[model samples]
Target: MLLSGQSHAATESRLFLDGKELSLPEKVEIENLDGNVMIPIRVVVENLGFKVTWNQKSQSVKIEQRDKVVQLVVNDLMATVDGKQESLNAAPLLRKGSVVVPIRFVSEQMGMEVDWNNVDKVVSLITPVIEPTIKEPVKVPPTTGSGTSSPTTAPVVEPSVMLSQVNTIQFSENQLKISLSASVQPKISRLTGPDRIVLDLPNTMFSDSFRASQGLDNKLNGRLEVSGYPDVSGVRYSLFSSSPSTVRVVIDLNSAKKYTLLTETTDSTLITVQLREEDSVNIDPIVPNVPAVNDGRKKVVIDAGHGGSDPGATSISKKMEKDFTLAVALKVEQLLLQEPAIELIMTRNSDVYPTLQDRVDLANNMNADVFVSIHADSFSPTANGSQTFYYQRTNSKAFANVIHKYLIKATGFKDRGVTENGFFVIKKTKMPAVLLEVGFLSNSDNEALLFTEELQNKVAQGIVNGIKEYLGIK
Candidate 1:
């Protein structure tokens, strides 16, 4: 059994089981509420050779070891220890997907002694040792032809290696070098939405010297900021898991780029990540051209947020935010096309990804009058509303306020109001720009409403109305 202090206090406090220090998993922290030291129930109970189970229907937790069993309900001050009712100073609660309980109560009930050092703010759990019974080994009879039996031997195992250091260099290519005590193959993968390349090193741990060099204490993660590199932004490393001991290194990228792993030999201890701009390929390009009609029509650029490899936010029904944004943008385009006083330009017309820079360049080159980027918000499931965002510019705020009025009316959801934010599309564009968070994808009601064609048409009309009102057109 082991006990840890509260989340705020746990940063400086140390946790010890017997005499050895333990490292808590990332995002799992002990919390103290009132006077009780709360700990994640699964972390402490499961490590003490106990089986922990949860009942989803009843919202309760059960822990069993041999004939002893303990049960706890969420937000209930009473618990059951072997069919006998027991009172608790504080009830168990859930935080960040883990159930936390009073550490002292759980530790004592599980037949362990808990000690808290006030001076050092250290938590220690002492378990009683059970002696194993010894039995005499049976001797085998000697072989008929052999005088002595062959001596038995145990196989020797090699110690696991550790990652020693990480460094970056920028020359013709952005290079990331990882040093290790021994050679190991790294598993590589890619992620989008602020693109990144991930490298996973198996059976490795961070060395003490490397931890000290990176200013990492018991926390198993650190980041290094890289400057003067175009494609590469920063490098992050962490102890991803403990049972199999996997270390993960993520290379943050400003955009999608091509990379290669360089090593001298199969057993080389140095792994180099060579990053370079992806080879340019010709595709359908957006032509920055003004309308030839010479009529004094205001040019508006409609941007759909994320597409292609980037799905943006996933809705409650698992629908992609890109799909919703594109759908709404197309409807807005249809509405604006019928108007004689408006000229429309779309950042993306299909299921394609236009980088933030690409969108900004197109708007700037064409000299648009107003820019509106369509996107659906995402957060907790309970977060559902309509809002608009603008950068710090005065004209942008006026643009956002006008658009938000009609947007809230169209969505008919909660009015979250207009706010100021430095969104890339809105901030970089020279014209009056506003990014509309039409509704939340995480909310079931909003997701269903957004998929309806009637609502899409209404929202498109509202956006056009807002634009016309801002431009002083009837």
Candidate 2:
């Protein structure tokens, strides 16, 4: 099961040790009355945006809100909800003094929903409505190609994305004006075998026939340049587009140097190559241009934007964008985690809101192939549904297309249309990055559905599938 929770409540079954309904602790692990499975309640409740608590002295579990309290007794089959006699199908049992209940009945009664697969013996809980949840974003180190499947279920979650169709690249003019972020930097490496230079571009351009052009010999002379550059032997190039704002171009070089890069209007990527005299450069002119070899997978960075402090784009539902985004992000994470090759990373895993700059910084630092910032948009609840935004740049065109199609198919938000905006995260990111407005928080009708895990996962899965198509990975 890609998304599994502890034993969730099914029929409003609350545990009452006596006539007093007990409160459950926040983020505590509770076992079933049968004592078969221990469920981690933190992940579940966090997604649900509920307060959980445990009393060490009393050895009891309590979940309290502003007015209501749900209490459970250790090893006791009885529970109390707001101090009332409530019948329990399964009583709260004690484990080493702490009370635990079945995840099925409890999660449900506590204003959450659960899905059960009898055939597979799996239980998943969806928080009814996500409120304010704080989270932080951290960067993970690097890895190679050879992508594995995404763990949208129980097994895998990767930090990569794929590119599929190139929908459209709209330019205000025939030649679009695009700029790179100062924080956006590239890696320069030398390959051993072929005398070639490699360029790692953050994104692949949008064109029916678009690929990096590499040459070993100085083709400027048009002498059918073999590997004959005296200063540099050859060059290899590749571009992977995860978002409109991202692409990675790896230029294989004959020798290594401290290079400064600049892209000019003539479409020539100038690499002021300064190599050490320590190595002799070899060039090969006869070799044909090579295609970039992907690990055959893409990295997915599911950003639960606006955690801890900054809650971006709030709605009238009193539902913080931070919480809604986290809930959806979790769903996306769970769904992608099942895939073996698809590595998953959350820009914000908890309620803490991460800064826009830090969010982009993580993606860049991690060297993520693709970055998707999940956000629940808000306006007048009357103005509901979802729409995605990308930077107004030509480089991000391909990345935007792949994600655009998939989001429409998955979320089914009002096709607000893909437009250009100068969002801080996407523009500043060094990699292919896109900001997704899952749905309008201002829209009341859409918010109801937005709170569900099923819908959230479906949307998440759609994004994953879209990435897969872009990368040409099954």
Best by lDDT: 1
lDDT of model 2, residue 263: 35
Tell how far residue 387 is off in model 1, in angstroms: 1.2
- Worst window of 10 by summed lDDT in candidate 1: 145-154
Separately for all candidates shown, the number of backbone clashes (residues 3 or more apart, or on different chains) is 1, 134
Angstrom error of the Cα, residue 70, model 2: value is: 66
lDDT of 2 at 121: 37
- What tens digits encode model 2's per-residue C-alpha lDDT throughout 128-207? 22111112333423322211111111221123422222111111100111222221223333332222323333322323
- Candidate 1 residues lying further than 4 Å off, grouped into runs, are 1-294
Task: Please write out the lDDT profile of model 1 over residues 243-310, one tens digit for every residue.
Answer: 34557777888887656676535335666665544445331133333333457888889998888876
Candidate achieving the largest TM-score: 1
Q: Could you tell me the lDDT of residue 452 within candidate 1?
A: 93
**What C-alpha lDDT values do all the predictions have?**
0.70, 0.49
